[model samples]
Target: MEFKNVSVVKEANVYFDGKVTSRTVVFESGEKKTLGFMLEGDYKFNTDAEETMEILGGDMSVQLPGESEYTLYKKGESYVVPANASFEMTVDKYVDYCCSYKK
Candidate 1:
């Protein structure tokens, strides 16, 4: 039982090591743009509205702009991407736990 790949929810033969992971966004927070990210790496984006992402698995770091500071997130960890937060980070095997609006 893993949420990594929904395609074969019950099979464990193929290397599900991010072999194929996707999301079906059924309902979004119409108020702002939302997205689900997976893999190992930081995302670069500048938005008028704040974006949120949850660290479902793997190690990751959050680096905010204008500061030489960073926040670290581990497995089962969650954090919010502040509005106007021009930040960049490196994700070490990071997967996103996003809107459960799936098929």
Candidate 2:
């Protein structure tokens, strides 16, 4: 998505293995999101609020809480995670993603 003339605050310096990292972007409407890239690995994340994660590039296998199977999410696909819930992700390569938080 193209954001025209938007003000962004903060940068996400999250590093799972010091190789995977992300940058934070805040919108003017008070919503926040992160643009990140992940290497091949498994990751666990906890959310404080509801989140919609969009896969921008590459591929990943995701396992949400209570789900028995891992779902595949590729480029242009998205998934929603409930507030206070955690999710697991397995990246097979360098996956680019955008994670937006909802109020």
Prediction 2 TM-score vs. true = 0.90
Worst 10 residues of 2 by lDDT: 3-12
Q: Give the 10-residue window scoring lowest on summed lDDT in candidate 1.
A: 5-14
TM-score of each: 0.52, 0.90
Per-residue lDDT over 1-103 for candidate 1, one digit per residue giving the tens place of the 0 to 100 score:
2333223223322223643244443223323222345567556545345556565556567776666877887767766666665667676775555423111
Q: Which candidate has the highest lDDT of all? A: 2
Q: Once model 2 is optimally superposed onto the true structure by TM-score, how far is the C-alpha of residue 71 displaced, in angstroms?
A: 0.6
**Global Cα lDDT for candidate 2:** 0.86
* Full-model lDDT, candidate 1: 0.51
Give the per-residue lDDT of model 2 (tens digit) for 18-61: 65788877777877788889999998989899999999999999
Model 2, position 88, has a per-residue lDDT of 93
